[model samples]
Target: MSEALLEGGTRCLRNVLGRFATGVVAVAAADPADGTRAGLVANSFCSVSLEPALVSFCVAHTSGSWPLMRGAGLLAISILGAQQRAAADRLAASGTDKFHGLPWISSPGGAPVLEGSLAWLECTVEAEHPAGDHTIVVARVRALDAIADGEPLLFYRGTFGGFSR
Candidate 1:
């Protein structure tokens, strides 16, 4: 066996990382000052630590909506169900009415909590770190709940699929 170092560039790195499937979740927050809501779909959401009940999600440096979340004292995460591809797509798109026609409610902490989510986590920013071309946001869970029971939407190789699909 021989090991040869090859340069695959950014696309290769992304494609290699995409080999690991991850669950899709929407990380949303509302401006406590003005009541404006911002949401974005992310596949990088993950549980970071159990002792402090912390979670981490990565937001690209180019994300225009990520800045809006900075003012949020609380952020809400919605684990999307298998049937909610439209909701996921809506949140993933840019410069559109992401909340339009979607059923959701505001958490007591002021985060917009979407309806029909498999699970929900209302959190507050604990710490942030600058990672390469993305920002690693670590949040501490304040309130957590599972509103529904079902399979979640899985993203693999840059596409969505599930067990039954």
Candidate 2:
């Protein structure tokens, strides 16, 4: 209940959760009107349902890019491959152009889909719920495809790597 206990608990929770390996994804979108792009890398992406074709990802409340991307109407989730670690790092960083030199193409729905990704999904925002430090976004998939055959870029123990067969 004390401040010190709360701080320690937070740190511990993060450390504990880091043990679960997760695939990394880039959630991105382009403004249909002006061509501006916004994106962020996330390892908190997962399938939420199959009946209605839904997916979800978590975005930090502190992320400056989320607001811009959120209003873009449609979004693309690119499943990163091992070769795209640089792309992940660039998207994860703040205070700079995340797509300056990033090679990407627009999805059918006008969202930015990073090149060299293993797969991609274009979706529209279905719902958003406020979590502790992040917003849980549920998306309705409009289009999706497996782009290439490769191992996925993964995050584990606070670091990025690829899984081996």
lDDT of 1 at 136: 96
Error of 2 at 130 (Å): 0.9
Q: Candidate 1 lDDT, tens digit per residue, 21-127?
A: 98999999988888788899999999999988999999999998888987777899999999888899999999997888888877767798888889899999999
RMSD (Å) of each candidate, 1 decimal: 2.3, 2.1
Query: Per-residue lDDT of 28-145 in model 2, one digit per residue for the tens?
Result: 9998899899999999999999989999998888999999988888999999999999999999899789999999988987899999999999999999999999999999999999
Runs in model 1 lying further than 4 Å from the true structure: 1-6
Off by over 4 Å in 2: 1-7
Task: Itemize residue pairs with steric clashes in candidate 2.
Answer: none
**TM of each candidate vs. truth:** 0.92, 0.94
Residue 11 accuracy (lDDT) in model 2? 85
Please report, as a residue range, the 10-residue window in candidate 2 with the lowest summed lDDT.
1-10
